[model samples]
Target: MRMLLNIRIPHEPFNAFVRDGTIEEVMAKIPEAMKPEAAYFTEQSGGRGAILVINPDEPSQTPAFAEPWFLTFNADCEFRVVLLPEDLQKAGLEMLGSKWK
Candidate 1:
């Protein structure tokens, strides 16, 4: 089944992932956002912004709030994986299994 793995990593780690191509591997065949990598938007005053990783195949025609930059993941089924910043390393290790170096 296809899945969307949403991960939250520290700014440094996120940059490293992009540099090392880990992000590419995770999203499989999909297009990433342009510059500024991370997008931010506020729903209300004093509200924190969110980072969004979208699935390319699941397109929505309607206009929506902007923020949490959009990333498209080409997958066949619907799935969600949410990981916190601290769990990135462990989660990556698990995804790659023992063969990952």
Candidate 2:
């Protein structure tokens, strides 16, 4: 079964993760922005899995922009972790793994 986990990360830590390729590595690949406020998609582990990063701060002035973004994983056992800008650092990999399992 696939699950979605919501988390928060501080700005600095979040940026650091992005810089070190942690986020990209976990998500499998880079995300593509479908709508300004929706979300982005990426493949994880050389296409073994996938991830979707939903930007809560996406533009919401229009209905079209209110849609939630998503990332699709082609693998059978897959999950998505949606991290808010504030909870990145507070949420660790172990915690996520436990929650997912």
Candidate 3:
């Protein structure tokens, strides 16, 4: 399944990384290692943030995707399952809703 990884980096270690110039290396390496479908960097709640789209083969692989960011930047990571248009069509939402109703 596809997943959206909401990553929020706090200022402390992140700012230090940016200052020392390790952030450049990290930015290049981590994303390359993860091979995310997409990566968008932004600010969230007054802090550095990123949204990474990844498709992990197993739930157990979550840590593989999140750990480096957490360890390197003291980031907070949240994972949410996401559906593409085809996935939504496959979900049979109408049937489920009718049955539940």
State each model's C-alpha RMSD to the native.
16.8, 15.2, 0.8
Model 3 C-alpha lDDT per residue in residues 1-101, reported as the tens digit of each score: 79999999899887787898888888899999999999999999988899999999999999999999988888899999999999999999999999999
The lDDT values for all models are 0.36, 0.37, 0.94
The residue pairs that clash in candidate 1, if any, are 52-68, 56-73
Stronger candidate by lDDT (1 vs 3): 3
Cα-based lDDT at residue 6, candidate 3? 98
Candidate topping TM-score: 3
In candidate 3, which residue ranges exceed 4 Å CA deviation? none
TM-score of each: 0.20, 0.20, 0.96
Q: Pull out the clashing pairs in model 3.
A: none
